[model samples]
Target: MENIQCFRPTKAVIDLQAIRDNVVHLKNMLQPEVQIIAVVKANAYGHGDIEVARTAMEAGATILAVATPDEAVHMREYFPQVGILVLGATPISFVPYAAANDIMLAVFSQEWVEQAAKQNIDRSLKLHIKIDTGMGRIGVSTRDELQQLYDAITAASHMLVDGVFTHFATADEEDTKYFDKQVKMFKDFLQLLPKKPRLVHVANTATSLIKDASLQFDAVRYGISMYGLAPSPYVETILPFPLRPAFSLQTELVYVKKIKAGQSVGYGATYTAEEDCYVGTLPIGYADGMIRKLCGQNVLVDGKFAPIIGRICMDQCMILLPTAYNIGEKVTLIGTQQGVTISIDDWAGKLETINYEVPCIITNRVPRIYSN
Candidate 1:
């Protein structure tokens, strides 16, 4: 049978079921009047953008948000019926392509608004004006700036100003003063504009969880949470909902050995066997986006934990497996099955990274297998 197939050192398994659940769950966290814009940028944080985007829309998302124009175009091409907004800036020269493809653009500058008006393209263009209340990044800084751009935008009937939004610099921080200030700034800017926007959004994943009912705008951008992850450190401590992690990484044992005392293992000869012990080699390593820092980490096998014993090489690594598990048996690197567990959060902590980067770190060379 194909039970004994080629085994790789590292693999990332995605749970689309959890993704679907998270989308619906996140949407429910907001009010009925609020809409959800699922942030699918960075390839849905490496959970496969095309797959996650389709799931997100079906689950509860009204619009799919991307960080760049290219990602927006990619999503638009793959899912023609879906609405896409390029949350980041698109060059003036690329306007025709964006309009022809019906991609929404984020306009923060008068220069870009003027360009969109001058382009005078036949197709309709959706624009979401960004505000720089406290993010210290791109967007309109003051109400005066927004009024000028809004006036120019409305003058051009060809362009449609669909929404006005801002980014929160510290929504996830312990202090909510900065985020509170941004809320006021966005509201004040809205009053200055002559036309009322169809949608007003500012909350990202972090702000989406806040208790401030007034902070709730017309919509919110759901990012890391859509992949069953929190946007920041305080989410679990702050939010009412418990976020479930949706990814598990695993591989199989390829070789086994009994190393005598004083035997050194792997590169740099750093690990020395202290006693007569069994060792195992796995097919995963840094090349597969398995961080080498987890060399001393533990993986689960045969309902017991095996400590990884030495420097992690590029294509292979060593694990101290028990005498019970045989070849072709499953290895649990980041999962809980058969009364064993090796959490992805634990793995991320060892690598000195966040849970968000853990998914992104898994290389595309490893195929993602989905589970219920």
Candidate 2:
């Protein structure tokens, strides 16, 4: 077996410039006073968090947002002064950790405030209230619940309301019925608040890009779009500016051979050659987040397209090549080669998923290389 960690050229190359441009584009599109909170969650959506966070902040983002307490903690190492907001719930037990690190937690219930107040920690915690304006997730759904939660937080000397936000379920879709309903509910929730928080945010990447400008509150959580990815296929068409994808997957051919006509390749003998053909083996497969279902997808080699011929293996996969190639020839699995390009959208379409899942699934084994 080959050494998996040494000399393997498989990498997820990230372009910092694309991220900076995207953030600046979003900043320019928003009102002068509206702030851009770069959503650096999910390891910056699998493009590497610390790198993306620094680049985004340098490009004008004033805040950083993540999905969990651990993520918030990890971000604190690199960004000591910038605001870090946990979009997901932080258990009361971990509340002290967040408060100490100056990280804000999203509270959706009055019970959360009650528990946080019980903690003896001396530091005050900045918090955001998530109103369930229609994501149907962790948020207060009714006016009474909102009022109670607001009062509870305000009552606690250790807790301070810094922001209030909601997520939209259909902001990326073409239809406006559900999207408008969410906006209305968010407005109604705001009406019930005794006094508004310093930051009132509900616009996500999709909402900020395609929805009404009034929805762009004090700040917008720029998530997928900050990484230069369209929120959905529909949003791609209406995007205010062109988005340059910041991610690409690359590798190199490790082995090559010519198979005779009628020969089968890969496990289970699922691929049989109709004629003598060149087959190239790559040092990447399912364990690297290439998942088995993508067995028949196309990969770019030498500026041309090659079909993946059989079941992708745990450590290797076979691609039909036009001709015999050197063992170290470059291969493009998810990027531009010559004039052709393979995009995450292409992979998502074949897998029946979304662009977000495409990069998120590309396991950590593949090293991430950054570029300007």
Among all windows of 10 consecutive residues in model 1, the one with the lowest summed lDDT is: 1-10
Model 1, runs deviating above 4 Å: 1-10, 116-120, 155-157
- Candidate 1 structure quality by residue, lDDT tens digits, 115-220: 6778858987778888889888789897778878787777786788988888888887888787778778888888877777888888888878765656667888
Q: How far does residue 260 in candidate 1 sit from its true spot (Å)?
A: 1.8
Compute each candidate's TM-score over C-alphas: 0.90, 0.97
lDDT of 2 at 152: 91
Q: List the residue pairs that clash in candidate 2.
A: none
Model 2 CA deviation exceeding 4 Å by range: 1-6
All models, RMSD in angstroms: 3.1, 2.8
